[model samples]
Target: MKAGWTSKPLEDACTFINGLWKGDKDPLKTVGVIRNTNFTKDGALDDTDIAFIEVEVKKFDKRKLFAGDIILEKSGGGPKQAVGRVVLFDKPEGDYSFSNFTAAIRVKSPDELDAKYLHKFLHWTYLSGVTEGMQSNSTGIRNLDGDKYKAIQVSYPSIGNQRRIVTLLDEAFADIATAKANAEKNLQNAGALFQSQLTTLFNRRAKRATHTTLGQATGGIFTGPFGSLLHKQDYIENGIPLVNPAHISQNGIEPDDRKTVSGETAKRLANYIMRTGDIVIGRRGEMGRCALVTDAEDGWLCGTGSFFIKPSSRCDAGYLVHLLRSDQCKQQLENIAGGAVMPNLSNTDLSNFALELPPVEDQKQIVAEIEEAKESVERLKSIYRQKLTALDDLKKSLLHQAFSGQLTQ
Candidate 1:
C-alpha cells in the first residue's frame, strides 16, 4: 500500500514446476531427488536424507533444480503440521531434482521479484497459519490448494527495497538465532548439572552402602493386573483412575484422565490398588521410569504396564524412587528385562534387583538435597526457557514488520 508499490498474485509473478515421481531406476545411475524431508523447519534446504531415482537424461535435464528455486511442500502433512512448507534451494553439488510431493516456483521476472524474498514471505505465510488454513485433508494426508496458494497476493516495493529488507532480516535473525542457541544451551546445561549431581550422589552412596535385594528391603512387590483380568473395554468415562506407565514421570505419578475404570471393574482388579509412598516402576517400554505414589495417587488401580513396589520401614519411598531412576539401577533392571517385542520387568526381576540401602535418616537427607538441587536447576531452566520463547516471538515480530514494509520505514 506504499507509493509506487504493487501487489500481485504469486501465479502472476512466478511459474510453478512439478517434481518427478519415483520410478524404477538403478541407484548407481540415478540422480539425487529432494523429498519433503529435505525441507528444514526454518525453510532452508537440508542436504541430508536425500533420495536417488533413475530417470532418462532428457527427463533429468527437464526437471533439474537450479539455484534460487523455491520448493513448496504440496502434500503429505499431518494434522498438526500443515502443508505448503517452502524452502529455498541454492543449487548444491551434484544433479538434484525434487519429489512429486513438492512443486518449485521460479520467478518469471528476476528483475521485478527476488526468490529469497518470496521464500521468506512464504515461510511467514506458513508460520502465520494462512497456508495451514488453505490445506485440505483427505485420507489423513493434508494437501495445499495450489490454486488458492497461487492466488495469495503479495505486496512489495522495488527490488532494491526488497534486498534491503532481506538484509536487515538476515542480520536480525542471525542475532536471534545465536541468542536462542545460547539460551537453549544454558537450559540443557541446567538439566545436565542436576543429572550429574544425581549420578554422583547415587554412585557415592552405593560405594559406602550395604547392598540388598529390593525384596529384602521392601514389604511387597506386585505387578499390575494382567491384560486378561482387565480389558481395555472395561475403561469407563468417570471412574477410578488406572495409573499406567505413561502416567509415571520423574517428578511424580501423573494419572491419565482417559484411563479410568468403573467401580465394578476396579473391584475385580482390587489386588493392584496403589498406596501412598508406593514406588511405581514402568513394567514395560522405557527403562528406569519410576515415581513415588503420593496421597492423590493412592487407591488408583495400577494398569498392566506398571509395577508397584511397597516400600518397608527399612527404605524411604522417595529414596527408592530416586534409586530406580539412577543409571546404575536402570542398567541392572534392563539387564534382566526380557520380551521379544517390548522390554518387560517382572515381579521376580524387581524383587531380585540389588539396591544400596543406607540409614533411613540418611536416605531422607539425600532426597532433600537432591530435591533442592533439582529445584535450583529447574529455576534456571525456566528463566532460559522464557528468554528463548521471547526470542522466538521477536523473530516473528521482525518477520511481520519486514513483510509489511515497516522495516525499511
Candidate 2:
C-alpha cells in the first residue's frame, strides 16, 4: 500500500446486494436464480453447464446482478475449499438473475478499486480464515452469510498495488493453465501408447489355442449370490468398496464412484472379498467392460452385477487387464452382449472365450516393458501435478497477503 493511502474494512468498503422480489413477478413464469456453477480452480466463473430453477415462487426470490459485483456460491463444504471463491461478474448483457444459493457483492466504487482486482483478492486462502470449516444447514449446501463477510479485516494497498496484484494473478493463472493442458495431453499420450503396445502384441498370428469357458480356465468362481438387497439404497461409506457392472473400466475401476457398505453388514458378507489378480467384468450396463485388480484392497467387494473371473493358472494380472481392454477383446465381448436396456455377458459365453496365449517368457517380457513405460509416465505426471498444486497454493497466499496489507512495495 502507498504510504499516504488509507484503507477501510470490507464492511465499510462493500455492501451485500439483495434483490427483493418485485411486485407482479410470478415466480413460476419467471426463471429462478442462475447459479455460479461450473467454477474453475482459478475462480473463473464457468456457466457452460448452467442450471436454472423452474419452481413457481414469489417475485422476491430473484437476485439481480450487476457488472463488477462478485458472484459467490451460497453452499459450502467439500474437498474443495469454498471461501474466496470470488467471481467477477462482467456480463455485458447482465441478463442473468442470481439464485438464493449465491450472494452478490457491490463495491463502493468501481473506479476506486478494479472489479477484477477485488475478485482476485477475495479468493486468497486467507479468506478461508473467514469461511472455511463453517457449518451448513444441509448436505452439499454451504452458506456464508453477509455478517461473517463483514467482520473480515482487509488490508488495502494503493490502487496501483491492487492493479499489480491482479496482473500477477493473471500471469500466474496463464502459466498454470498451460501446464495443466500439457499434463492432460501427456496423460492421454501415455494411455494411447500403452493401448498401442497391447494391440501390437496381440495382433500377430498364432495358432488358436483350444477354447474353454472362463469357468474352465479358473479354479473357483462365485458371485454375490447372497440375494442381499443392494438396491443402491444399501450403499454406505467406509463399509465396503462395491463394484458393479457400471464401474467396469478398461484400465480398472472408477474408484471414485463405487458404492460403500457398512462394516457390520459387510462383515457378514465377507465372502464377497475381491482378491488381487481378480478380473472383474461388467455384466450389465457397458456389458463386457472389464478390469483387473492390480493389487488387493481389504473390504473390496463386488455386487451381483459383476462377474468374477478367476484364472485357472497363475497368470499376469496386468496382462489380462490389458488384454481385456484391447480392441479385440472388446469386440468379442460385445458380440456376446445381451440384455434389453442394459446388456450383460452370461457365464456360458465367458466360459467359451479364447485368447491366443503368448509364451510364458514373452508374457513376462511384455509385462516388464509395459510396467517400465507406465512408471515413467506416472512419475512425470506426478511432477506436473505437484507443480500445479503448488502454484495454486501460491495464488491463494498472494490473495491473503494483499487483503491483510502485508503485500506492499
The candidate scoring highest on lDDT is 1
Candidate 1 clashing pairs? none
Q: 1-409 in candidate 1: lDDT tens per residue?
A: 6677779999999999988865544333488898889887778889878887677666566678888889999998886788989999887567888888999899998889888888899999888889887989888889889999999998888899898899998999899989988998998888778778988877666655778889999988888888889777988776799878798877677777778998888788889998888888888987899888888888888788988888799999888887788766777777789664788888888889877788788888889988898888888989999998899788889889888879875
Worst 10 residues of 1 by lDDT: 20-29
Off by over 4 Å in 2: 1-7, 18-33, 51-62, 76-84, 126-130, 204-221, 229-278, 281-302, 314-316, 325-354, 397-409
Query: What TM-score would candidate 1 get against the native?
Result: 0.89
lDDT of 2: 0.64
What overall lDDT goes with each candidate model? Answer: 0.84, 0.64
- Model 2: per-residue lDDT, tens digit, 1-409? 4465566667777877653333453445444344645556567777776555444355433455667778766565465555436677677663456655566777887657677776776676334555664435555665665576666655556678778777766776787778777776776776677667667665542442333445655655566534555556667655567777666664567653336777776776777778777777766666457777656453478777877766546455566666666666777787777555766776667666775666545656667776777687678767767776776676667666666555544
* Model 1: residues with Cα > 4 Å off, grouped in runs: 25-29, 55-62, 203-208, 335-342
